[model samples]
Target: MVLSAKTKQSGVTSTTNMDKPNNSKRPLSHATDSTRTSESCDVLVLSNKMMTNLTSEFLTEQTTQPDVISKVLLERNKLKDLPFELVDFINLEVINLSYNCFHQFPSVICEMLSLREIIMVGCEIEALPSNFDQLSGLETIILDLNHLRKIGDTLCTLNKLTTLSLGMNYFSVFYSTLPDQITKLNLDNNHLAVFPDCILALANLRQLNLSFNRIKELPVEIDGLTELEELLIVKNRLHALPSTICNLV
Candidate 1:
């Protein structure tokens, strides 16, 4: 990997060179900034053909745009209307497809057993597939800024999910089933007025973002999120948080 550095008052600003090779059959890798800077920042160029040759490839914790990548970003790229047959060729372990314009998630994704994480933020998706529970190895699923109103029980079956993002959606239905393995959850920008008790089941949860919602009060049992580390409740209608949260932050 080649490193490019620039002068900054704080220190050296470095960007990794991840340009994709010019190959039509290659799986391009797109790069996303953890800081959420610009839309045209960088792409994590990859060789789709080369990656297909490998048995196991892990690409955890990477962000992507909507149009180019299938796993990350807002608008589906019109140029990448791959056939459903290509689903079997995918071997990605982590996929961050947040902030996109997909109306619905492809049903073929259920066949991808190798996918460990799926991040589809700001998409127009409404509901997850019924077979989503088949993803036994899935550990993280971030689906923010969507038009979804309810989560399927199939999703709650992902017992290995550690992080979940359901922010900016239409949660009209009451959540009764929550994954037990979630450690970080983002429920900001929703239509919630009260903190649901169902979330307390996540014994390992460390961070909870509930900002920009219609919540007016919190549950007293919120301290049940024992492993809580950071709780972001900004821009909400909440009058106060439980005193127990003070020690977690």
Candidate 2:
């Protein structure tokens, strides 16, 4: 599945129809009262009888033809663990589990081989699974507003990854090395104190965001990012920009 637009940071709306699921009866889950105020809940209220029938049909179809079930949106469900039945969707390519109460990255997602994009914003995720590299087809990952302190080295093994967003986290250092295929990277609103030299290795990087951090200075080696087009360094502690930045002109 081709993603036509980037995931927005404000709300759970998408610009493309691909983000919408095929079944109209299945609505996106909402935040539970324990996770959010009742006034904030946007759950679709269905009669108990209707819900039971829908659930029965869903299980039957999923059990018989799991490959037909692709694209899942469980946003704002306050879920700590995915339902075991979700594993039946073997052909899933896109999944959005954003705005939940997860304390760790759900291991069930790691088992999906066809996943191309995953959005898990505003959660308590601390770390990715060690075997996250198993998702070779993954291209975009948005983990903004989580509790991640550092990423595993397995992330760099996703050679097809092009867009990665890790903003609004608690990272104090850039520990994980990025893949050279990355085109857009967002590290804004973190606790980084140093410019990671590993970023210079992304020869295909076109957009980079380092805003709202504690970085003191950038290295002259940044000039090596010849493909960079838009660089955002706002709200940082940088004293001066390197003269080599003018080379981009």
Candidate 3:
């Protein structure tokens, strides 16, 4: 359930199985050229190593060449800062750095012009970069279980984004204007007290989750979601059903 990727580099798009048995405990710097076999493909799988300890020579030796690696899986490695050499992978399309120690959204990610998806769940991220909208090719972003207290307005500028998950964060209000193409939105387990009026703008939304919040009433505007097929608002403090909800059918 971590991040995965498909790369046009190496003319190969493969998924790295994090479940693979780690038979090599050798330091990444000592990994022989033989380890870069077809079995590893384009994935540089590290087993529970602290990324901060990796030397630039070790990284360069592992990748051999920047264009040879199109996908990088650094999840669960307790990464605090992105490797400075990662920008060399000019064709990178996906990045999954979940379950790490990141406290702020890495600004270095914006430099990957080819990135299509970013998964960073269970981090301490408090805010995204101001120019995050420059990632025009990004299509999916998952930032669940972070420390975010509010959605950024720049999020609406990613015209290609279709899925966004912000569940289990510290959000008290929903004020950002999401792109119209977003089909799935997760805002579960936040501190919201009232329904966000911005939800009405997602005309193409098909699924929405607002569970485990402090909302007290359903807005009559809920009927504006004509394309919605699944709505989850359980665990709120609703006293009565809004009659306008009948218009959903």
Give the winner by lDDT. Answer: 3
lDDT of 3 by residue, 1-249 (tens): 111112222333222333321321111111223223234566666535666554567778877776666556666667777756677888877677777887978777988888887877788899888888888888778888889987668888899998788888898998988899998788878899998888889999876777678887778987888897556666666665577876764
Lowest-lDDT window of 10 residues in candidate 2?
23-32
Q: What is the total number of backbone clashes in candidate 3? A: 0
Candidate 1 local lDDT, residue 159: 76
Comparing 2 with 3 on TM-score, the higher-scoring candidate is 3
lDDT of 3: 0.71
Comparison by lDDT, 1 against 3, better one: 3
Candidate achieving higher lDDT, 2 or 3: 3
What are the clashing pairs of model 3?
none
lDDT of each: 0.56, 0.68, 0.71
Cα lDDT over the full model 1: 0.56
TM-scores of the models, in the given order?
Answer: 0.66, 0.75, 0.80
What is every candidate's alpha-carbon RMSD to the true fold? 13.7, 11.1, 13.0
CA displacement after TM-score superposition, residue 114 of candidate 2 (Å): 0.5
Ranking by TM-score: 3, 2, 1
